[model samples]
Target: MTTERKAARLPVFDRAAATPEQEAVLDEILSGPRGNLAGPFLAWIASPELAEHAQRLGAFCRYSTGLPLRLSELAILITAVQWRAQAEWQIHYPIAIDAGVSADVAQALLEGRRPVFVDTDEALIYDFAVELYGAKRVSDMTFAKAEERFGHETTVNLVGLLGYYALVAMTLNVFAMRANEDEPLPFNE
Candidate 1:
């Protein structure tokens, strides 16, 4: 008996075949902090209008939001795990660590275990994100603590960051995006 294995594929659009609107959106993304079109952008470009709006919103959530990089990346990591988004996890894991999330925490998360956080803010963000992901809403205590630690604007941004990364994770999953061959799944499943 013979068995067949499917080859990995990524459904990327060719800029050479792009419509004017698609070209414009691609240009905007390439010119932004992203400095390149990759990952979810490749899939999103299929609908230029959606791409434009989503990329802008993503830029705000990733770059302009009041949440620090570590916190935002923490939220993104949680979203990635919730969605089992290999692409998102591959891209953000190192950034999360560089932004000050501990390696132990990241590893524990990847192992599908609760991370031991040494920082109060890290603990708060982890609890808030996990509760939100698991319950679709945080408990009043978690919400109150997040609001107190992060303040109103930052708290709102944290929610937005979670939501934005969730969208990214969904896009990557729907498109069957794959991480590089060398990069293993960040979570144990």
Candidate 2:
């Protein structure tokens, strides 16, 4: 029974079988600028029960534009780190860089260090990410401040972004997704 429990604790990716749809999703994601995609991401999308909804959620959370794209990416990056999701962090760190996030800041967040060049806005968002992910609740002060600084639409978008990547982080970690060798991690792989 102990051995069975131990085996159950292992990641699902070890037993994942790639279907045609899974390969297609992986191909699409890898075809993006990053040029490398993790297998677990594709596996999640390939599961018919989760695929369509995952696609919608991914698009709405990441690609939908309104709030500063950079900040949204940064928030997601920070959430990935707080979750200790190496695969999710690896996937988004480059996207954050492409969106104008600095390599130093990315490294700092990944290494459990406070970011140096964080602006007031970025810092507020980071605080929100930490609080939300760590405690699963946002303080009233944080909500008020975010509302005042970013306005309601952006605030809503921020929440959605957080929810989106949090789900991704869980899936990636549970699957133990491997980072593609073709695309190295930011700030030293």
Candidate 3:
């Protein structure tokens, strides 16, 4: 049986007829490290002010975070799984692989299985994200482990990164944003 896809709740930002504020915001994002306005930005552009702040926070979380790319991307994937956010998973899966997370790990996550993390740091990050999402707070012991392994600054940055990606996931889900028609959906749900 074929299923009809619902239309996106918001208008995808059109740069041609954009307002001055939209143009400026789009320009800022386009020139940033993330050259393309993919994922959340497609909906965020409608609210230029929110887009600016969210994109800035996202840039810092994605690029300037103290955690290594592998761990940061892992945290992002964890958030994607938690929220069932296909856009987040699709965009980050390749980056995560290149950053050292194995296909096994990504596959397990997408399958809702417990991924056997060979990297101790990946395991620690997975635990941290699980607690943060499941319990709404990390245990003191988990926090201590993260702080010990990553130091206070990096640990704090890891927490910030998870929160930022959760925001991204929510935005994509809210707008029903997704990958191209030809791209397979990451989650079966």
Candidate 4:
């Protein structure tokens, strides 16, 4: 007989089991743009102090940043790809599409191929993010192009968006977070 082993769930703080500080942080997250707590926040709440500040920073990066939703989501998808964080990819892929990223572009990114960008801004975001993640820094030409087209503030926000999502991806990856079973894996590998 073959034996099947169930996947181990990471130790995540539930509202009922939360400390007073953790509950306060959970309440704040529930009331924020996030609406419900899940993913990285589950792991983060274990460290209530860090969770409080991190969630606020995440809310700013995700909601109030200078970059439009499409660009910000694009940067997030790039971060997910870089980290191969399935949970992050699953969460952001639909949001990215809703924000104007094409299905073809998202599919190409999933397959580790160069995406056919439908917009100039999309192309710029992909190039800048891929270069930054792969090279640890973008070349002067790429930086200049991003700054010229998006403005210095938007460019800086894009960087921050990328970094914030990278942190989310790292948390998801470290905790072996899984997406909904109905969702397809973002990458085959």
Which candidate comes out best when scored by lDDT? 3
Residue ranges of candidate 3 with Cα displaced over 4 Å: 1-7
Local error of candidate 4 at residue 75 (angstroms): 1.0
lDDT string for model 1 (12-126, tens) is: 4666778999989988998999886656877787799999999999999999888888988888887888889888988888889999888898878877888887888888988
Which candidate gets the maximum TM-score versus the true structure?
3
Q: State each candidate's clash count.
A: 0, 0, 0, 0
Tens digits of per-residue lDDT for model 3 on 1-189? 111343348654456768889888888998999987778887787789999999999999998888889888999999999999988998899999999999999999888887998889999999999899999999999999999999999888988899999999999888777755568999876
Candidates 1 and 4 compared: the better one by TM-score is: 4
lDDT of 2 at 104: 91
TM-score per model over all chains:
0.91, 0.74, 0.94, 0.91
Better-scoring candidate (lDDT), 2 or 3: 3
Residue pairs clashing, model 3: none
lDDT tens digits, residue span 1-189, model 4? 111111254563456666899888888998988897656877787689999999998999998778889888888888898899988898889899999888898888887888987799889999999999999999999999999998998889888888988999988887777666566766664
Count of backbone collisions within predicted model 4: 0
Q: Say which prediction, candidate 3 or candidate 4, comes out ahead on TM-score.
A: 3
Clashes of 1: 0
Q: Output the worst ten-in-a-row residue range by lDDT, candidate 3.
A: 1-10
